[model samples]
Target: MDDSTIRLALERHWAASDAGDFTAEHDIYAEGAVLDYPQSGERIRGRANIRQSRLVQPNTKRFKVRRIIGTGDLWVTEYVLTYDGAPSYTVSIMEFRDGLVVYETQYFADPFVPAPSRADLVERPGTEAP
Candidate 1:
């Protein structure tokens, strides 16, 4: 796929996720695609399984994409994922083949306070985590 096409697919995927449209959200993945959560040491294989994992999650969810940058068949997305009103900074790395995602790994982390030693050299632009 062309850069524009891939980007559009990614945009659509995230949009579907934000809208809670599960079918649309998983449409970009190949049937055998795999998703990994390294922090939790979990790997979910297959598109149907991937979708099922999400479907079973009980939290009220929201996604706010900050940026997407990549080329060719590799892409990375950085975003804030909020569950039940708590935000977790998240990064998703995706690998594509035949214009569909074949493998993806996502990492999530809660925000942390800036170290006091760096206060003089850093500026804060976002609010503290709740």
Candidate 2:
């Protein structure tokens, strides 16, 4: 997909999420797409799994895209999510093929620092557990 197309797709996804429209989201995600939320310890594989997993909480808020950078089939975006609590920063990396997102990975950017010093993944309960 082109840069604009990818941006539109992401915007539509977030719009549907904020509006609580799962059907719309189903159409946007690729058939085999996967979603990983480390903070929530949720890892969903395939569009169907993602379709079933929706944030229905009344207080879960919206995200504003700050920037989107692309190179070839890879697209990266930085965004801010505002909810009941403090806002959070997120970065999304997506790989597109045949004008559709074939792979995607997102990382929490705010209040989340890697290396230096921190607890290991083993200490985390469900996510690291085999």
Candidate 3:
């Protein structure tokens, strides 16, 4: 698929996710797509299985996309997933075939407080440095 097409597909996917619309979110996956959650050691094969797995999740979640970057058939999206008011940073790497996602691996991370020693080197989002 062309760059613009892939980008639009990704945007639509994320938008569906943010809206908590599982059907629309999973529509971009191919029938035999594979999804991997490396952190959880889980591999969900087939688009149907992936959709079912997400449908059973109990958390009330939302996605805030930070960035989406790639070319050709490989793409990576970084986003913050908020579940029950707790945010988890996530990265999803996808490989597409014929404009549909065929293989994907996702990683999730919890937020951590900034270390005191590095306070001068980094800036926090809302607080002003003293």
Candidate 4:
């Protein structure tokens, strides 16, 4: 698919998630699509199962898209997912075929404080220099 089309699809997916519309968010997948959570080591096969799994989630979730970079049938979306008021950095890599997502893997990481040892070597962005 073209870049614009892929971007639109991703926008729709994020919008749906932000609105708590699970069905619309899950509709981007094909019938036999696979969704993997690498952090949890869980593989959810089939779009129906994936939808069902999300339906059982207990936390109040919100998504803020940070960046989307992709070409052809492969795309990566970086976003912050806030669950119960705690933000988690997330990356989702999706492989699409025939205009539908066929395979996807997602990674989640919680925010952490910078290591003191790296303070001298690293410059933090969006912060005033000390």
Q: Which runs in model 1 stand beyond 4 Å of their true positions?
A: 126-130
- The candidate that wins on TM-score is 1
| TM-score-superior candidate, 2 or 4 | 4
Residue-level lDDT tens digits of model 2 in 49-79:
7766664445676777787788667888788
lDDT of 1 by residue, 1-130 (tens): 9878999999999999999999999999999999999999999999999999999999999999999999999999999999999999999999999999999999999989889998988766685565
Q: What is the C-alpha local distance difference test score of candidate 1? A: 0.96
lDDT of 4 by residue, 87-125 (tens): 999999999998899999999999999999888998766
By TM-score, rank the candidates, best first: 1, 3, 4, 2
Could you give me the TM-score of model 2 versus the true structure?
A: 0.66
Better of 1 and 4 by TM-score: 1
Worst 10 residues of 3 by lDDT: 121-130
For residues 1-130, could you state the per-residue lDDT of candidate 3 as single tens digits?
A: 7999999999999999989899999999999999999888999999999999999999999999999999999999999999999999999999999999999999999999879998789866678766
Error of 3 at 124 (Å): 2.8
Model 1 — TM-score against the truth? Answer: 0.95
Which numbered prediction scores highest in lDDT against the true structure?
1
TM-score of each: 0.95, 0.66, 0.94, 0.92
